[model samples]
Target: MIIEIKVPSPGESITEVEIGSWLVEDGAVVAKDQEIAEVESDKATLTIVASEGGKIEIKAEEGEAVEVGAVVCTIDTSVEAPAAPAEPKEKEEAPEEEKEKPEAKAAEEKKSVPESSEHDKVKVTSVAKEMMKEHDLSLDDVINGLKRLGKKEVEAVVNAPQATAAAIPQKEATRDEERQRMSSLRRKLSARLISVKNETAMLTTFNEIDMSYVMDMRKKYQQKFVDIHGFKVGFMSFFTKAVATAMDFHPMVNAQIDGEEIVMPQFVDVGIAVSTPKGLMVPIVRNAESKSIPAIELEIKELAEKARNKKITVEELQGGTFTITNGGVFGSLLSTPILNPPQSGILGMHNIVERPVAVNGQVVIRPMMYVALSYDHRIIDGKDSVGFLVKLKELLENPERLFTGGKDAGELMLGI
Candidate 1:
């Protein structure tokens, strides 16, 4: 019987997809449920698997665009996959007399070659040595096989300087160019970025935060946190928590504009922008405002791993109210991140550096980082954008404030 393998729908409203690559060759035997090919859509890359164990005949070529329910391949279930060969059993020990004869033969072969200094200095690549051994040829036989001595070879030796013979060789120059077709994911990403710039009234506000408190907290409780949570705490979790908490006071930063009215979500679903080989993917962390730091870290790690491995689903990439992107991982000092469409705000994190600043009327050094908040200015005003960043700075500078609803611990305790 022949079974057809069709392309699965990646998500809603996606009609066509490009064949990313074929994991197996044409007419190759595949096992049941084995992944045979990868399909790239505008949102994510998904795999096509075999339904039964058999020989597969590919119908769709790589890089070809096919419909959502098109048959990309067919499997001949009548032809079963080849079985694995059995392992060999242990062999009986050889006689001492037989073992000595092989060693004696090696000694005789060793004595046939001359022991000279010139031969000692000759370098042989591992591949060349292996080939010579397989052919039962000696170094002398290889040397004699090179019957011609060209002018270029003689000039290399005679024109050599007296200093060292290990001077680097000059490479020949050539002009070459190559081009490749962009995948569906990349093309979609380009279009979305351009649309975001043209459609929204985007504005960016910048601020600096003294990272001494967060750094000190991580250094102090990292081990204990890891021991209990099974993963180390990271700076992104702190920033995510801060953003979620700060949104409580300045809700407009998280609100988005509908056709005729502004829509506000009661819960915060923070999107973490992860860079992958295909393109940038934002996996939403649901209800981030209600989760703890450790829980957030573990979920981020799992979601990032899935995205990079091309195992994430389209549902995992949708329904995010806000996004946070860290350019610090790439050593970027500062960047005004572009807004993800339909979402009003995005926070950009930059690298931390030790800089001099005034503290208590004294000049001191502290670890500081620059943060940028880019929001749609149509619904968000300068006061809300600036105040949102100030609230984030307060939460991150005093990380304990995150636990107390973005208020100082003393102030909360004293009811001030």
Candidate 2:
């Protein structure tokens, strides 16, 4: 019996998905519930699992776009019949011609000329092909070179040899052969970013926060927190707590414009900006104020993993009251982060380095991180935005106050 397999619905609002990769080869026996392929959806990447144990035949290939419930493969589960003893299969001998293929490829890569296809030319990337065309090199030669030394060697040939006498005929160079299917998530990202650009009077305001206190606190408690909760306590927890405190204090910063009316959210659903192969996704941690530092850390880590694996849901991506993006992980010294739509503000965290500072009129080396809060200028006034960031900085610099809800709110936030 052949069991037909179809693409499963990944999440809400995702009607289609791009087949990203196949984990098992055709005719390979896969166990029931074994992950066989990965699909990229608007919400996240989902693993296509085997429904029944069997040898499979694939109808879909990698990088192909398929719709939900579309038949993608067939699983055969037929009983094997007895047959006569088969002859011993001899191992194939390596052809001498094939053995020299590597040396040929290497020689081709070393060639200063590029290749053009006379037989249905593989339109190489523009720059590489152009350089080759000018030198009147054959596509077979270039491909052979690529096969020998790989693309990096070929790239060096294309990039370094810009000095070819400009004699190549001008070919209308608009055709592209690299047909990568865009994931649903990427399309959504484009649409949302365009909406933000067109619909909102977005303006970015910048400020730097000193992470010395936050860093020290993490160093002080990270190991113990990890040991107790089975996950390391991270700066994100402190930042989220600080953002929640600041939002509670300056409700305006948490507010967004609803055309004729201003919409203010009483609950703090802080969106964490996580970068994935699909791009930047901000998965919100709803009502972050209620979660402890350990809980917050776990939730953020889980959400980020989901985002990477393409297991995130549309609901998880929606309803972000505010966003926090940390560029520090990528070694960004400082950056002005863009606003994620509907939300008025986004926080940008940067890499920390010890800088000279005057503390009590004395110079000392203190570890510091620069922070930025970009806001929609139309709704968030300069004073409120700046003041809100100041509040964030103050809480972060003294994280104990974040647990205590700033200097005046005491430790009521922690329910202690």
Which candidate number would show the highest TM-score if scored against the true structure? 1
For lDDT, the strongest prediction is: 1
Please report, in order, the local distance difference test score of every candidate based on alpha carbons: 0.91, 0.80
TM-score of each: 0.79, 0.71
Give the range of the ten consecutive residues with the poorest summed lDDT in model 2.
112-121
Q: Output the lDDT of residue 126, model 1.
A: 77
Q: Cα lDDT for residue 387, model 2?
A: 90
Query: 78, model 2: CA deviation in Å?
Result: 3.1
Quote the positional error of residue 220 for candidate 1 in Å: 1.6
> Over the stretch 212-250, how does candidate 1's per-residue lDDT look in tens digits?
999999999999998888889999999988999999999
Query: Please, what are the lDDT tens digits per residue for candidate 2 over residues 1-416?
Result: 98999998766667888888899999888878888998887656678898888889999988888989999999987733235489999989888776667777766664544443354534467787667656756667656655356788678777763545577667786866787666666887788889888877776666666677777878987788878888787888888888888887789888888877999988899999999876778889999877777788889999999888767776787787899998999999988888887889988888888999888999988888888888888888888888988898888777778666677454464655
Off by more than 4 A, model 1: 82-166, 169-172
The residue pairs in collision within model 1 are none
How far in Å is the alpha carbon of 262 misplaced in model 2?
A: 2.2
For candidate 1, what is the lDDT? 0.91
